[model samples]
Target: MPHDQTTGIPPLKHALTRLLLILAIIAALPAAAESAGKPEAAPDIDIRTAQREFRLSSLRGNVIYLDFWASWCTPCRESFPWMNRMEQKYSARGFKIIAINLDEDRSRAEVFLKKYPARFTIGFDAAGKSAEIFDVRGMPSSYLIDRQGKLITRHIGFRQKDTAGLESAIRSALNRQESK
Candidate 1:
């Protein structure tokens, strides 16, 4: 009797080959998905200064915790200390914090800074351009921007317990930059 070519291969061998192919395809999916969804680092977004004329880009080689806040916001005020601490701890490791004040009056920002005494870089968004660009809907909103200038995460509200999570996120961003 002549053997059928399809049946010549053992059933176990056919099943094993199919399983291997499925596994290989599954392994490739994650890489393809990541490549498709990965965000391009945008380090070129210039921040408008307090005078509402000068545009300045945030630091390029650092993880930037860009906090959009107003002096009158209680939650913004409360988050200041935690932000300051994170700045103090990570500034040396290429981590930077930029407090962009949303107040129309630069004096309000100056006063708030005086009271809080943040060591990180401060910028004034007197014309509210930063808020509009970042789409800030409320005070105390923050965006964690990676070293390559891609926005990694955004938080709309401030909570004391979130400090660790934010710090870890910054660290992860830094690590990703370093690896690349």
Candidate 2:
């Protein structure tokens, strides 16, 4: 038997091969696209000192700014004063700022805290469990949570160089709560 000139192979075989290749390509496309903008799931955290579990779910009904920092992070050090001011300004307005420290040594963190005292609650994530939960890729990463306890925004790095924008975010969250 002579093969088809167009495909240089049997017609049925060529068609089947082409069909399979197309299906394969189509199947692989979704996986690639899915990875591009995957939504991260929040991790579980325990606030032992506070005698409360610090899961993301518990933050609902309060506007929260969760800052992930360490004793060694320069930006974190710079941002501390601003964070302190934010805590003082928003605490009575149903806004809570939680600073999750990614430090291994509590003593080091405590010493650092003395230099930059914070009015807000501070939690230690010695094993980096909270960082893993929050999908923190860098120091000074912040997550703004609405009153409903849902994550509204994720800030990867600190560029404000001051707390002006950070205060704005807190105010925005407070405003959003008031509107609703």
lDDT tens string, model 1, 1-180?
344477786667777888999999999999999976776553344565444433335376778888888889888878888888888888888888878877888788889878887776677767876688777888788988776677788898898788779878988887888888
Across 1-180, the per-residue lDDT of candidate 2 in tens digits comes to 567897689888888999999999999999988865453433446653334555656766788888888889888887788778777877888888888888898888888899988788888878987788677999889988777665667887776654576677778879978987
For all predicted structures, in order, the TM-scores are 0.72, 0.70
Q: Look at candidate 1 and give me any clashing residue pairs.
A: none
* Model 2: how far residue 131 lies from native, Å: 0.5
Model 2: which ten-residue window has the lowest total lDDT? 36-45
lDDT of 2: 0.78
lDDT of each: 0.78, 0.78
